[model samples]
Target: MSAGKGLFVSFEGIDGSGKSTQARLLAEALRADGREVVLTREPGGSPGAEEIRALVLQGDPERWSAETELLLFTAARRDHLERTIQPALACGATVICDRFADSTRMYQGLSRGDLRRAVDTLHDLMIGVEPDLTILIDMDPAAALSRAKARATAEERFEDFGIGLQEKMRAGFLALAEEFATRFAVIDGNRAPEAVAEDVLAALKARA
Candidate 1:
């Protein structure tokens, strides 16, 4: 199932679910074991994609409609795949992505509208690759939202949608884990970061 010699792993969850921290932890662990790790993020993994990221993540929630967001995200992802993800995997480096298409599936596909079909079609047509393994950090929407708001980053557009969006996203992500069960490892994110990292590492080892 690996697209290349290296393993491709993606972390997915609602905002503030600690998936990003876990992605970094796993990358460090892999490197400590002598594996070459390429840790990156969606919507901004490559130069062009990063430019798109600013547009999509910094504006008002209503700035871009769900349909527009879908197109923008897909474009960023295409660039990310071509300039960052594929090349890393082709060279036998473990590619640890913070967020991948599943985020699009939940946010753009189900958030404002039922654009799942469009998301899938574009994915198949422009970006056919899937992560060899996906780690989903699961947690309560309320708690996760609080953590997310605490960050107060410029990319708070998504967070601005409030707990309602987080609630919906959490449920959608859980459903997604079931839909893609074969490649997913659902880990609880309610514990301390180190504890969560332990589970994340364990999931990776289990997948291996």
Candidate 2:
């Protein structure tokens, strides 16, 4: 699904998988190629989502449960889609997102263990739009976690996570990518950022 006239390309992986860097690189690459690109992130992009993102990522843990966190993410995604993503797509822009529906399916589903339920909740009632392409950056969880620990400001409710959970999340992402291989491209995020960007561009061209 082109999601309409434009393309919806998303970046997804575990927390420290370098999606932000790749997304920026891809956006720059697209612009350099003379295409209009919009760079955005889930639980963000729009004002409402940004606020919800702060609440979900930074608020007291006591205020949010697994289900609550999932719901907040859904709300942010809905708002982001309606206010930012859809319009950008409709205007014929290539929307490069830092993360999307897959992130929720993997993270929240791993945290809650009901992947089907999470997927159902997000798409069952919507207009039913899926991504055109999903770039999944593959990185070793242990190494990614070490980098995150060294660089993070305050841990999210999920980032205080054990190594086991991070591994589970990584596996979940890979499994989900397998399920949607046609739209999923796994890039080696363990390499240098420049190298990863090159792989990303090549993977995208291959997909195209």
Candidate 3:
């Protein structure tokens, strides 16, 4: 919503809820309509951020304490904003991010209730940017965990937390959407990808 700047859209949901796929589909659809779009993801977008991504996502999930993880994520986000996101928006390109600050809020804050204030405070002070629109792909945790497990990757630290954590994450995301209704579009992600993509497009058009 920056003055005359391009649209900023972010996808958020529990792992394997297909938010990443939906974000890509939306970007493709926008480009088909002749809109300039930039597709990116958090924890890694710019060069410096990607390096940080490796540090945070690889190895043991307990490699960093909750506070340390938050700091790393914040640092990466700052770098991404400075090097990638801001530049794209300045040039009037719709930037579609796979995840944003909402993920940090849900993962870090909801995981430990007391940390919510810290996350918001750090965000306000260091990373004040918020997406113009955030698409939350809601899905059952069991299904999402299945989908997430099917994809084998070295960066499985987040997924390693297992089903219980994913269920908590789903609830956290839903609560967040309700809290920020004006900027959120909640989409059912239990259906087929094509169907979900159609719904996502419809929601974006409605907002537009």
TM-score leader: 1
Model 3 over residues 103-188: C-alpha lDDT tens digits?
99988878734588999999999889999889999999999988988898898898898888998999899999999999999999
- Model 1 scores a C-alpha lDDT of 0.93
**Model 1: per-residue Cα lDDT at residue 68:** 93
lDDT at position 41, candidate 2: 95
The alpha-carbon lDDT assigned to residue 97 of candidate 3 equals 94
Return the candidate ranking by lDDT, descending: 1, 3, 2
lDDT for 40 (candidate 2): 98
Among all windows of 10 consecutive residues in model 2, the one with the lowest summed lDDT is 118-127
- How many angstroms is residue 18 displaced in model 2 relative to the true structure, after the best TM-score fit? 0.7
Query: What are the lDDT figures for the candidates, one per model?
Result: 0.93, 0.83, 0.91
TM-score of each: 0.98, 0.93, 0.97
Worst 10 residues of 1 by lDDT: 1-10
TM-score of 2: 0.93
In model 1, where do residues sit more than 4 Å from their true spots?
A: none
> Which prediction has more favorable TM-score, 1 or 2?
1
